[model samples]
Target: MMPRPPAPAARPRRMVSAFTGLDVCETAGLRLAPGAARVLFEQDRWVFAALIDAHRMVLDRELIWEFAEILNPCWRTVAKEILLALLAPQHEAVLECAHAIRSVRSPRTCFRFLQQFTDWFNWLTDQGVTRLDDVTQHMCERYLEERHWSVPVPGEPRRRLEPDTMAEVVRAMQLPVLYGELLSRDGCTEGFAPWEGKSASAVVGLKKGGPNRVPAVPDLVLQPLLATCLYLVNVVGPHVADLLDVVRAEADSGQDLPRVTKERVPAVREVLARLRAAGEPLPALSTDVVGRRVGRYGADPLTHLAWGRLARMAGASVFNEYAREQVLPEVQELAAEVGIERPWARQAALIAQADSGEQVPWTDPVGDEDLQLMANYVVTACLVLTSALSGMRTSELLELSVGCRQSRSVPGGGIRYGLAGRLIKGKRFGGVPDEWVVIEQVDRAVALAERLVRRPQGAPLFGSVGLSDRVKNLRGWLERTGNREHWGLPVIPQGPTSPRMLRRTLALSIAERPGGLLAAKIALKHISVATAEGYAARPGGSQRLFHAEMHAAEEEHHMKLTLQAFRDAQAGIMPAGPGARGLIDALRHVDAQLNEAARTDPKVLTDDRHLESLLRKLAKALHVGPANFCWFRDPSKALCLRLAGTPDATRPLVGLCDSARCPQATHHRSQRPVWIGTITTIDALLDSPRVAKGEKTRLVPERDRALRVVAEIDAAASTAPAGKD
Candidate 1:
């Protein structure tokens, strides 16, 4: 082996001021605009956009790294140099700092870490630590301890940081150590290798699999919430559309356009004539507004007429000073005759009928504010329906546009519905075009949403509002007494809900059915069942339901049969099969328990809960089949296992099960339908001309067996006294 050369000596400790002339962006090899000047370590801020492509996340105001927030100029310069090294190419970083950049992928990642880093430095500053090199291990450990239950923001209450958040804080501390050589001497922490070389995740003890902390919306809240939203979109939507059309037609008729008094007077008189004929009152202020004007401003209640509404209806800008003097007296006389109650001239009467048979008007009076509020409610309903049914993320739903609905016919004459939208999750540069297969309800909701919020073709259907806030507003609207009582909507249970929760809820609901694992995987667009399983097993998700549903179904089927048999025994019906003796004994045991319980309470036999517990053990032994119930207490006598030459098997193979002759199987009234169907099938086969002698012989025996089972069931039913059990 060759001898090695001596290692180079470390650079001497120095102040960040010594590196003032360094062009940090150029050193990091960041992309730059044409002829842009270099960003130096001396500056208090770094405008990263001047050096690279526009960031997708940061707003225009956040384009720059404002090191001024650090307060100390020396610490600011050191912070910039350390972050610049993190931005360097992997090879460059390895050459300079002797460590490869791992955590940060883009400037946004570094930007997220910056705030926590600032908090830690601010805390250090408060401790009277003047420089990074003076940051001792004791101080770093103490900061971690304090942050475990500290106020995250200035005015917020104290909270223990979640595992994910604590991990981020630990990563912030480890970054300085990773780039210690790249930082000035005073910038590096004097620690004994932060956390003793443990990774941030290990130190914080984050779970191995990504544990989705977002919970599914509980069924109690989701059921009525979706029901009310569906009512708005499917039932109330057309009325809103018609009213909006009327509103738009009046607005677009050029009625509100500027016009001379002489040209508009006849139009105003014509509107009055129509209102008089229809017996509609002129628009007026509400009682509260009338009182406010009379008491506060001392104006006559008669002068509170909505003259602006009249002017717009008559193709004039407003009821001007001259026109009001001319029209005021005539309007006052008409108001006194007909009375002014509603704000709108034409109302949608009886929009919905309550369950108690009360006719509900769309609204008492559709004022401008009221109309807008109804329209907003319609939009909120559409949003809720679309999110719950389609499981689309907020970003994807916001990317939906007008006329995005598409449909195609399936082979079975069914139409498959889909909505065209952009997938905003993985694709960064203009999102990838995708289509979501949805139910008919979501399609109707999208249509209603388009009508509520008018947008041109290909324009975004919804605005970029926070989904959480929108859902909160929707629940608030539903809680209003006027809206609830008038609309006849059910009470929406209170709980936190969001787009992510809706998505996870959809995943969980689908995963709790038979053959639902595959359905959930497809519906959620997951690449594998394992991924869907993880979603179903999330914290506060449907883990219990997903695991227990299949077993519960089998157990429920057994319990039903066991309970029915006991009822038959009470009615003088008896079992008659190879396994009849065992089934009769089990029924006798259930009867004995009921008799004992009835000693204390005469109604114990009628109690379903008490009966269930008594019969539960016997129910577990009953394995239901198509034509028989296998009392599978002992696997040694299982006909299916014996025929398959595996008598030690824990479960019987249904295909090989000869329930008719099995000693552990019994037939009852419930099996009568299967026996009748079998006989019908055998008779059909025997009557066919294609039957050979051997096939006819086989069919005859099968038909006879089915007839005998049917005879036994009929005899047992005939012997039971009518109106007994």
Candidate 2:
């Protein structure tokens, strides 16, 4: 006690002052923060160059946008931890951690690790964590259950991290051990293996199927959109082409149409008002689409621009839609053909009632606007057809160039169509040129789009009409199609028509149908089979949707069979076979699980888990076999199969079995009808008068065998265990 503890060795004053002055939390050369001090020279420089160079977009844009002000809080806190850890004698371990983070796939991922780790470390700080060595596995788990992201929706309720998000947090916390560099570095390894034997399930329960889960587009929307898309490509598009050819061939050269000037503006506005007042559906045209329509629809009078497309095309006068005095006769005829009932008719009637002395009841129908209106519909149709058949996302569809069609024949017979384009999503660069294999429908739509898109253009196949505007117009097309008396289909959708829904619909069909994940792999262009398997449980887990559904369908079928057996048991209609007791045991297990659920619900089984458990028990021995019901089709248990010397056949050779003697055959109440019918047939066969004594001798033994099976089944049922819940 007297030997005054050698004054605790002094810290280097200059280094302490430098560390105190610096913002150590900032990430400097991937040292957890961009501006963080205490940077490792060669190690940090390489990581900085790799991260900013490789994962720039994820870091500079997406990550920043995702976590704004809260990001600095994360940076500041983690910086403090790094300063403390590095100030210790052994600083190389922390440097190793920095180098390992640079090894992540992208700068985005590297930053994400930094962010999540900071979150964990900061929470640890509150829990009084002085160094990384002080961290514990229990503390890691508690952080998983209790951590929340910094970003919050203004007025929405906030909760702790979701199970999937928590799983990512666990991954981040465990990264130090996961990366080989962290382990090999020279340092004390006290807390290095805190999560060595643990799994994600040990920390949190998984969640499945919610708002984030992709759902198939409804059939009503899918059908009409498909039909209309084809119609536009195969039918209307050709008509528009034919007209353009005729116009160009006319050498009709430069005939001018009437243009509205300042003096004619009042009259033009009157016609527009009349059209609106008459209750017709107005087109939802974006400014760009409206501008295009003015030139193409000859409605340049409304645009007020003297040098509009329609005006430019005429080379002189303008064909103003409003100035066309009477309703165009051709438009009225087409309207009648489509059964629109001329919304102008009602307005004309109202005008007649007003009767201001010089006026007769008058109507002005759609006029030159008809052709352009149909053109808009055709554009949406083309988009729908291509989008649905191609399985391209919205961004990819928009990125499509005018010449995005490619087709070739492989060694196989079917012609393969590939849509040439760049894949934009998850691409570090401006995506690479990857051609997607497509169906014939998509090829046709692409051909039509090539013809329709304005020449002298860039990458976009569809013009500047935005996707939101297109989706809105798509719904309008359905409403107009469904309400039209000329159309027979009642095909209005009660849902939205976003590109996402169409892609999801195709995915659901591929996953749920007879086609498996391999089919989805081809359609979605996923490089790995594992990517398509993500469609099963959300966040991509072990069980795929196809396998889960297939198992479910099999179980549902078996349960129906089991319920029939249970009903037969209740009625005391014992089956006539040697395997009856096995089925009786199955019925007892079913009663036990179902009764437990029935106690609370009192109707159908409300507990899925209990039903699943019951099905598992029933599946072990219940194999539907020919002739007699076989409880165990297992090769080792089957007398016929064992005698024939086979190993694990999927089904038994029932015709080869000794039906009356095979121990695996379980006779049930449902089988009673078959036995009764069989015994009647046996009696008939035995009574045939034409039979010789020798033939009857052979028949007598077979008849005796059938009767013996019936006797054994009755005896077994009588001695069977009584079923109870």
lDDT tens digits, residue span 265-372, model 1: 778888888888888888776444555768887886475676767787676767666767776677777888777664653555686543354776766676554566
Model 2 C-alpha lDDT per residue in residues 580-665, reported as the tens digit of each score = 56566666777776777678775774445566676665664555543466666446778778767774776676557776677777
**Candidate 2, lDDT over the whole model:** 0.50
Best by TM-score: 1
lDDT of each: 0.69, 0.50
Q: Lowest summed lDDT over 10 consecutive residues: which window, candidate 2?
A: 9-18
Error of 2 at 723 (Å): 24
Off by over 4 Å in 2: 1-60, 63-104, 107-162, 165-204, 207-213, 237-387, 390-404, 409-414, 420-437, 453-470, 476-491, 494-504, 507-725
